[model samples]
Target chain A: MTEVTEPAIETVTIDVVLSALADPVRLTFVRALDAAGDWTCGSDVLRETGVTIGKSTLSHHIKVLRDAGLIRTRVDGIRRLVTLRYDEVEQRFPGLLAMLREHGPARARGISSPYTSG
Target chain B: MTEVTEPAIETVTIDVVLSALADPVRLTFVRALDAAGDWTCGSDVLRETGVTIGKSTLSHHIKVLRDAGLIRTRVDGIRRLVTLRYDEVEQRFPGLLAMLREHGPARARGISSPYTSG
Candidate 1:
């Protein structure tokens, strides 16, 4: 099995992060992960996010998010787990996640996440 | 003179907005407009924003922003005045501008605009 590694926090650029979130499907996926709290099983992302993209496409989106350092993935036996790298991202871009969560249409859909003033 | 109109606010999508903000040069330009507060002259944008892109490319970026409903432009004699569609964007995405301007790398570089907590 190939090793699963996330990009270093310092390597994550704002442009890359924004680009990753620029897709509606990816944005929705991030919101679902955000709503998941600690971590979410990889399979649940599509169901929770309601993204219509197929499994292959979803895997691609997940790769983009992970490459941008927006998320972390852990390999647990056959099942993989994913979680938002909220603290690292917030530290790098400051209030970005909160801003999107608070105001971007992400929060208004499935998850009524508490307001986070950026 | 062709009538210059920005895309309607309702038509603006977050994906487009994020994609518009994804480019480093364009993000810098938006930051300059944010610092300018109101109606920055087009010529001043390149100078003020320090975007090194050629004129044609800058125009393209401006068009993308306009199409995304992130900005507005007005024709004044030979000069075109461009301004951030702050209120409309705020109503649409809320805290997005503030996120970039407030904590984004935009403010840390040159203009130290008053901190806005998104």
Candidate 2:
């Protein structure tokens, strides 16, 4: 479909992607999205990610991820949906997203697990 | 050796580390420090990284990286020396530092190689 095009992935840098995933709340969003298949709605994202960030902050977070090309969004009816550009990301910097998925939150909280409080 | 104590790696979080690296200037500093082994003087760091960030800004970047526990600093006579806490970091989060060393700068500038312009 000519309605959408995947970014070349080359235009996206690891810094932006990494920084996008660097935040605790954003990582939560990424994790929730990762567990979700393709095309999750904004409301679902909020519910699944369990983020309490204000509406504007949520909007900002979405913008940061979109601006970094880490995700692409589309409108369906009255809802905006998002999906990860993991394939393009993997091509851009191999193992980047996978590492983030597996280790990002553990690393971010400064501990591998909640029970292992630092 | 009662002069300084290394931070317990467990206290460091990946968010701080990732965000610290998410900056271009700081990544350059990290790259320079990674290559520098155990001890590089502050002057050598600025010279080696070729960063034009002013004194206080440089201090701030160093603090960001240091606070993240990615590096350690010590005073030697008239100069302060900086070193990567690679072993500690590796233990805290495996493959994290190595990946950063190999792919950090390339990802930050949004290009893997300077020769390949975006």
Candidate 3:
């Protein structure tokens, strides 16, 4: 399969960021990047999710996140290092990350419970 | 125009929430709701954005946000009260809002600066 060229940097928008994050797989990837704090290859990042994903799909998801400006990637030798662009995204959408922190499981008083629909 | 029925509650997905927030107008609305901490009519909410928006368009956007579980709305008499579902969204997407808060302009040392491309 041919790899699609990444989107132009100029076209990055909030929609792209939200769309990229809408996926559970992609969200997991981002959380891992947040935890790793450095460039991580796709395989290493997906380990925590316990899901087996195809390489192409993973690449696509990364591209989406990159396009949304949620993550930044650099080519180091033959490996691409991915890091969360927390600062950039937070700048664009204020009050978003703080809200997430308040609800983070790590800070929760008990086992992180799923949200209830009332 | 005919109103589309709201999406099934079960079908409400993170993608929908992200997609709703991807828009500038919608984000502004959520911010206002966060500030207000109560239900607000669409017309009142759009005033802060300084954009002239149609009712149908606003309805559509609200539906998107509601479906994403980022917001909860209740009918108060004939008016719909819209409030940010900060807890629910934060629960599902941990560390997101906290990150946003760190970047929020209100907390910024200076005028909230738009994100710069690097």
Give the alpha carbon lDDT tens digit for every residue of A1-118 in model 3: 3332444443455445666766768766776566566667776666544548988988888887877777777776767777766676565666544443433322224423232111
Q: After superposition, how far is residue A49 of candidate 3 from its true place, in Å?
A: 7.9
Please tell me which model should have the higher DockQ, number 1 or number 2: 1
Model 3 scores a TM of 0.52
Give the higher-DockQ candidate: 2 or 3. 2
Highest DockQ model number: 1
Per-candidate TM vs. native? 0.72, 0.75, 0.52
TM-score-best of 1 and 2: 2
Give residue B92's lDDT in candidate 1 (0 to 100).
79
Which residue pairs overlap in candidate 2's backbone?
none
**Model 1 pairs in collision:** none
Per-residue CA lDDT of model 1 for A9-78, tens digit only, reads 8777676888888888888778767766667775676765455667788788889999989999888777
Shift of residue B87 alpha carbon in model 1, Å: 2.9
Off by over 4 Å in 2: A1-6, A54-56, A104-118, B102-118
Computed on C-alphas against the true complex, the DockQ of each candidate is 0.34, 0.33, 0.20
Q: Please rank every candidate by TM-score, starting with the best.
A: 2, 1, 3
